[model samples]
Target: MNWRIETKKTALLLIDLQDKLLSVIENRERVVQKAVQIVKLAKLFSLPLYISEQVPEKLGTTCKEILEVAGDVPRLSKNTFSASPILPADIPKNILVCGIETHICVRQTVYDLRMRDKTPYVLGDAIGSRNQIDHQLGIEEMRQDRVLITSVEAIAWEMIEKAEGAFFKEFLSILK
Candidate 1:
C-alpha cells in the first residue's frame, strides 16, 4: 500500500494523554514532549488537531502544554476505548495518533479507524503504555490491522519536505 502524506487531508488524534493516565506511563515526560512537538507541527502545517480524554472525570485533563497547543480544537470526552464514534463525523482523511495506554485506547482507536476505512498512522515515539510490553503489543496489534506506524520527526518532515523556506524554518525551530 502506498503511504501518502497530505497535510490538508490529515488530522492529529491525541488519545487519553491526560495527567492521570500519563503519570503511569513509562517515559511519560518524553512521550508528552514528543506529543507537544507533534501538536506544534500540526498547527504550523494547518492540519486539524483532535484530542480525547478517556472519561476526563476519571483520567483528568490532558497536560497543560498539550491543551495549550491544541488551542480551539475541541477535545472529545469518551467512555469507550475508541474515540472514532465520538469524534465529529465531518473529520475525513488520515489520522496521526499519539497518546498513553497504547494496548488499550491506542489499539482500539486504530482498530476502529481501520474498520471505518480511515487511514490511521501511529506516531510510535509519541505513544506510551504503563510498561514496555504493552506498548510493543499495541504497536504489533496496530501493525496487524495494517496501520502505518511511524515517528513524529518523520511525519513532520514528510509534511514539510524541503529544509528551506519559512514553513521548513519554523518547523525546524519548533523541533529544536
Candidate 2:
C-alpha cells in the first residue's frame, strides 16, 4: 500500500485537545501551535478535519487557537477515550492525528483506528503528555504497532509532494 499521505485520501483528527487537559501537558504551547498549523493546512487543502473533546463540560472545549483555524470542522464531544466511535462516517481511510495525553487518549484512538482497518498516522511533535516518559512510551508503542509516527513538517512536505506551483509556495510559507 502507498504509505505517503495523499491529500485526498487522508483526514486530520485532533483528539482531546481540551483546555483543561492541555494546560498540564508538557510543551503545551508547541503542541498547540503545531495543531493550529496542521488545521490551517487541512483548510488550505480542503481535507476533512475532525476534532474530539473527551468531556467538554469537565475538560472544556478544544483550545481557541485550534477552533479558530479549524473553522466549522466537526467537533465530537465524547466520553470515551478512544475517538473511533464518534468519528464521522465519511472520514477518509487514512487519519492524521495529533492531540494531548499521548499515552492515553491519543494512543487508544490510534489502536482503535488500527482495529477498524484504518491507517492512523500520529503526529509525534504535535502530541504531548504530562511527562516526557509517557510521551515517548506512547510513541514507541505506536511505532511498534506499525503506526506512522511523524512530525507536522514531515507530513506537510509529504503531502505537498513537489516543490512547484502556487499551493506549494503557500505551503512553503506556512512551513517557514
Candidate 3:
C-alpha cells in the first residue's frame, strides 16, 4: 500500500461531527482540537473539504470550531449513516476522514468510500465515539478492512514536509 499522503490529491472528509454529537462524544475537546488543526492544514494546501451532518435538525449543526475554520465549504445534509455518496464527484482520490460516532457514521463512510475505489484515511486522533470500547472496535474493524488508519500530526506533517517555510510556521502556531 502507498502510505505516503499526497496532499495535492487529498480531500478532508469530516463526517457528522455535529454539535449534538460533540456534546456527548468521548474526548470531545481533543477531537475538536485535532479536527480544527487538520482543517487549518487543508486550508493551507487548498485541499477540497467535504462536510456532512446527520440530520442537523435533530443533531444540531457541526461544532462552531470546525465551521469557523471550514470557511465557505459546502455541507451535505443526509440521514444515511454513510457519507460517501455525498462527496463531490471531482475530489481527489485520497480521502482524509474523521468525526463522531466511530462505530456508526465514520465506519460506514469508510466502507462506502472503499467501494467507490477511493483511498480513505481515517484520522485516529480526530475521530470519536460515545464510548472508548466502541471507538477502539471501530478502529479495529476499519483497520482490518485495509483502511489507512493514521494520526492527525503524522499525516499533516507528512503533507507539510520540511518545517522551514511560512506554511510550516503557520502550522506550528496551531499547536500553541
Candidate 4:
C-alpha cells in the first residue's frame, strides 16, 4: 500500500506514556524524547493530537513533558487498552501512534484503529516496553497486519516533502 504522510489528514496519538509506566521501560528517555519531537512536529504542521491515559487514577498521569507539549489537545482517560472509544469520533482518517508498552497499549490501539478503518502508522523508535522482546514482537505483529511502522524523522520529512518551504525549514531546525 502507498502510505503518504499527510499532516492535514493525520492525528498524532500519544498513548499510555504515564510516568509509572515509562519508568519501567528500558531507554525511557530516548523513547519519550522522540515522542516529544513527534508531538512537536504534529503541532507545527497543524495535525490534530490525541492522548490517552490508561486509567490515570491508577497508572498516574502522562509525563509532564508530553502533557505540556500536547497542550490543550484532547486527552482521554481510558481503561480499555484500545484507545478508539476514548478518542474523538471525528478524529482524522490517518493516525500516527507513539507510546510505551508496545505489546499492550500500542499493539491493541493499532489493531483497533485498523478495525475502525483508519490508517494507523506506528512510530517505531518512539515506542518502548520493559522488555525488548515484547517490543519487537509487537512491531512485527503490527507489520504482519499491514500497519506501517516508521520513524519520527521519516514521517516528519514526508509531511514536509521539500526542504525549501516554510514548513520544511522549520522541520529541519527541529531535527537539528
Candidate 5:
C-alpha cells in the first residue's frame, strides 16, 4: 500500500451518489461539487474511473454533474452496499473513494476493499450522510481501521506532486 497517491496505480471510485440519496445528504451541494472536481481530475490525469449506483431503479442514477464530466467511465449497478463484487478484477489496487451515505455504502465499501487488500482513500469532502454525526463517526471509524482519509484537493496535489508542470497548470484551470 503506497502512503502517497501514485496516479498511474490509482483508480477513482464514486459509489452510490444517486439523486434519491443526495436529496437527503446534509452536504449535498458540496458533495456534488467535490465529486465533479474529482471526476475532472481523473480525466485530466487519465486515471481509470468507476461509478457505482446502488439500485438505481429506486435511487436513480449517478448525478448529471458527475456523469457529464466522467465521459465514458464505467457505471456499475449493484444491489450490494460494497461495490467490490461488481468491480472488475483488473482495476488498480489504490482507490480514491467518494459517494453518498458515508456510514452505509461508502463505509462498507472501504472496509470490503481493505479485506481484498486494496488501499482505499476516502475523500472526506466528496462523501455525505443524512446526519452530520453519522458522517463524522463513519469517517472516524474508517480512520480507526487504518484507511486513509483525504480530501479531493489533498489527493489532487499529492498526485500532481509539484508546483510546476502541464498537469499542474491544467489542475489549476480545473480549480477555477
Candidate 6:
C-alpha cells in the first residue's frame, strides 16, 4: 500500500501481453510503448521482471515490441487467467502490473496477488481492454478493494526521485 515504488524492492508483473490479446485492446500501441518504458526501467533499476501469456498456444506469444525490450525476462505459459501460480514465491513485495484485457487476466492476477498477501500496483495507462468500460470497472473494483493503482510516470519519478545527471536525462528522453 506504499505510494512510492521502491526500485530495489519492486518487480514488474506483466500479464497476458500475448499476440491475440494485444490485437483487441483499446490502445495497443500506447500500452506497448509504456510497457517498453517500464521494461527499460526495470533493467536499469535491476528489478525482477516477469511476463505471462494466457495459453500461449492459443493466444500466441507476447508481442514482439515488448518481447524485444524485455530482454531475458521469464515467461509463463498456461491456460490460467491469473498468472500467480506460475510466479515464484520469492518475488518482490511490490508488484507493478500492466497488460491487455484488463478485466480478465489483469484483474484476476491482482486479486490473486492480494490473496497471497502481496502488494500489487496496477499501472493505469499501461493496461487496456477491447471494452473500455470493463477495463475501467476492473480498475475501480481493485482500487476500492485496496489494491494500489498508479501510472508509469508516477512510479518512475518516485523511483528516480529527481531528474538529475545523464541517466535521468536519458530515461526522460525515452518517454518522448
- Provide the clash count, candidate 2: 0
- Residue ranges of candidate 1 with Cα displaced over 4 Å: none
Candidate with better TM-score, 3 vs 6: 3
Compared with the true structure, model 6 gives a TM-score of: 0.94
Comparing 1 and 2 on lDDT, the stronger one: 2
Flag the better candidate by lDDT, 3 or 5. 5
Clashes of 4: 0
1-176: candidate 6 lDDT, tens digit per residue: 56667887799988888778788788888898899888888877788999988888777898899889897777888688888989999988889999967888888998998888888989989999898899899889888887878888888877887778988887787666
Task: List runs of model 4 lying over 4 Å from the truth.
Answer: none
Candidate 4 local lDDT, 1-176, one digit each (tens): 65677777898999999999999998899899999999889888899888889999998998998888788766789999888888877889999999978999999999988888899989999999999999999999889878899999998878886768776778887777
Per-residue lDDT of 1-176 in model 2, one digit per residue for the tens? Answer: 67677889899999988889988999999999999999888887888889999889887899999888888777899999899999866678889999988999999999989888888989998999999999999999889878899999999878887788997888877777
Best by lDDT: 5
Please report, in order, the local distance difference test score of every candidate based on alpha carbons: 0.88, 0.89, 0.89, 0.88, 0.90, 0.85
Candidate 1 lDDT over residue span 1-176, tens digit each: 65668888899899989988888899999899999999999999888888998898876888898988888777899999888888778776789999878899888888888788788889999999999999998899778867789999888878886888887789889989
Worst 10 residues of 2 by lDDT: 1-10
lDDT of 3 at 22: 88
Best by TM-score: 2
- Counting clashing residue pairs in each candidate, in order, gives 0, 0, 0, 0, 0, 0
User: What TM-score does each of the candidates earn?
Assistant: 0.94, 0.96, 0.95, 0.94, 0.95, 0.94
Task: At residue 126, give the lDDT of candidate 1.
Answer: 95
Look at candidate 4 and tell me the lDDT of residue 37: 94
| Stretches of model 3 off by over 4 angstroms after superposition | none
| Consecutive 10-residue window with the lowest summed lDDT within model 3 | 167-176
